[model samples]
Target: MRISIIDTSSLGDRSYLIDDGGVAVVVDPQRDIDRVLALAAERDATITHVLETHIHNDYVTGGLELSRLVDAEYVVPAGDDVAYDRLPARDGYVIEAGPMRFEVLHTPGHTHHHVSYVLRHDTQTAVFTGGSMLHGTTGRTDLIGADDTETLTHAQFHSVRRLAGELPDDTEVYPTHGFGSFCSATPASGDTSTIGEQRHTNPALTSDEEAYVENLLAALSAYPAYYAHMGVINAAGPAPVDLTMPATVDPDELRRRIDTGEWVVDLRSRTAFAAGHLAGTLGFELSGSFVTYLGWLYQWGAPLTLIADDPKQIVEARRELVRIGVDEVRGAATGAIDDMSAGSALRTYRVTDFTQLSSGIPSDATVLDVRQDSEYAESHVPGAVNIPLHELLARAEEVPAGEVWVHCGSGYRASIAASILDARNRTVVLIDDAFTNAVELGLAA
Candidate 1:
């Protein structure tokens, strides 16, 4: 028996491919299915099943398309109100693929329909606890709603305890969300752990149900704004991902699109974006956290034009955006901002350090903190309004009337906020310095 882990680092999500004597089962696949197909070919395995633990809220699942391509059964939780056809997986139902056997276990915590699959081959056992259990923590239960938060958190406690009590100590545990994922109540300690290790170390297992629910609810951070659309899209069935490069448009075409109010996303370094960019363009660098902010600020299904330094950056940006169901990439324009033939003037923002900011901020200027809510609660510059980068676009109007001074934990997110403020034609100052510098430089934090 062979098991392969497919880790998507940007979203901090994992999928699994378990192969037994040339037959395989795929669990919690991402939008890009090429890697899964390539793996199957390398192992000379026939994909017999594609399993989903729940209708994912973080990203689009490729399970439906992958099963269609491979002629395999696509299994989804029985209670999910999805429009597409799938094998209804219920608790205790067993599926066999060659020497491997998977038993379904309903675990309704992360979502009302969530389930875990336990696979066994000979004496070895492994459980794919998607969004229910993690290395040392459990999945966050707040994604559903404020009304269901306490209900789901309580459900999570029983679900986790059930796994620990029913499974053997040595059983291998593979969870879908953790390993730096915001989906977890806390950052995962490691990528993998056994039932025994998690039972001993996982806080969810040690705490009483009431305390566990309280702590779990308190620990959740704000998830991506794009998350609200994922479950609905998944339930309706997402379109197959198009891997081909988007059409390349000239400056005039890009200008025409922008004139019609289309979003122009500039994928460049924060420093590069601050130096110069197309006026009104969103500065979303193609870094690890790119998708998080992109999904946060971007209008779903709205036509989008991409501007990058090169073709490579556009390709990378598109790959990440599609995972969260932002597939309306109309076209792209590649070159430095100065090289574009469009008649519009290049725009730039003034970036200052903490020392300069500490000297004195303008009385009318608003200090915007673009970090997470938790980070703001820990320590923030005096008089700084907390509008996390992800929520800035929706709440930008709420910012007081004045020049906007934006700062994040690091300068990265502040740069993003600065760009948005610039697009809104607000005079902006980016505090492109570490947050700790604010305290050390004698600024109240």
Candidate 2:
């Protein structure tokens, strides 16, 4: 069997397409099925099976839609209480698709119903670990609930050991999560690894079960708020992804939307957004973390709109939003900021590097560190107030009255915080620089 990776870097997850002979099976596809279809077409393979390892908690699954489109069998874990029809996949059940033979293994860690697929063809063997045994760690056990975290963590330890014990040392490991995903119990290491490599490096393999559980729990950080919606949508079967452009809103309409407290997001670079943007519009630059942060802080089902320099940017941003089930993008505006300003003055903020911060900041300025609580505890600027970016919207009232200077690990998140403060009519300056520079320049205490 030949395997192809379908990476959705925005969410730090990967889907897989494995083909043997002329038949193919897709595993853990995102909501947008067009990319999977295109891959199958390019490979001259027919999709005969769409498999979901579990009801995902990070993004809506496209397995059901893709199966219907290709007339393939939709396979889901037998233990899940899903709403749609599916082929129930259970442990030790073997399935055949052309030359590929899949043996299902019930690995309940990430979610109670999660499973992994071990594929065998000719002389080669590989395992598709959806969220179980990741590269250097296991999938987080806390998504289900705080009450079940310890139970699942124990199960996770045994599950990883089972895979390591049963699978051959050379079995190539392909996991769907842990590629910079918050789903990981800890940050994943390396790009690719084998079962043998994992036995040596993975925390589940190297540490005792209790030690592993304690370390994993201690390291878990805040996940996106949108995650609460993904499992529900996936269990109910997600709607077909809509990638068509949203209605174009004129400058007047854009202004009205912003004035009415609607979500009119600016999808420009941090530097560009910091320089000038529509007053009251949010700056969630269309970058890797755009979907993640926006989904985290967004009011669910809100009538969203986008502002971009080009129509193509909005199109790309729309695709990202759909994966997280933020489907109510009501309108878009594309072109120069002046054109979309609708006769109002564009808001602007000053951005500077950390070296300037090291020299001196205004005595009356309040230094706002927008990194997470865990990140703040590691090292931070002396006397800087810590309000994580995800919490800024709800805690905006906590910011002190002064010229507020906001910053994060990189300037991306700080730009977001800066926009929020600017929209609130607060005097703000954005520290648009890497946090490492702050430590290197003796700015962090």
- Best candidate (score: TM-score): 2
Candidate 2 lDDT over residue span 187-290, tens digit each: 88887889999999999999998899999889889999999999999999899899999999999999999999999999989889888898899999999999
Which residue runs of candidate 2 sit more than 4 Å off their true CA positions? none
lDDT of 1 by residue, 69-89 (tens): 999999999999999899999
Residue pairs with clashing backbones, model 2: none
If scored against the real structure, what TM-score would every candidate get? Answer: 0.95, 0.99
| CA RMSD per model (angstroms) | 1.8, 0.7
Against the hidden true structure, what lDDT does model 2 obtain?
0.93
Which regions of candidate 1 are displaced past 4 Å?
359-365, 439-444
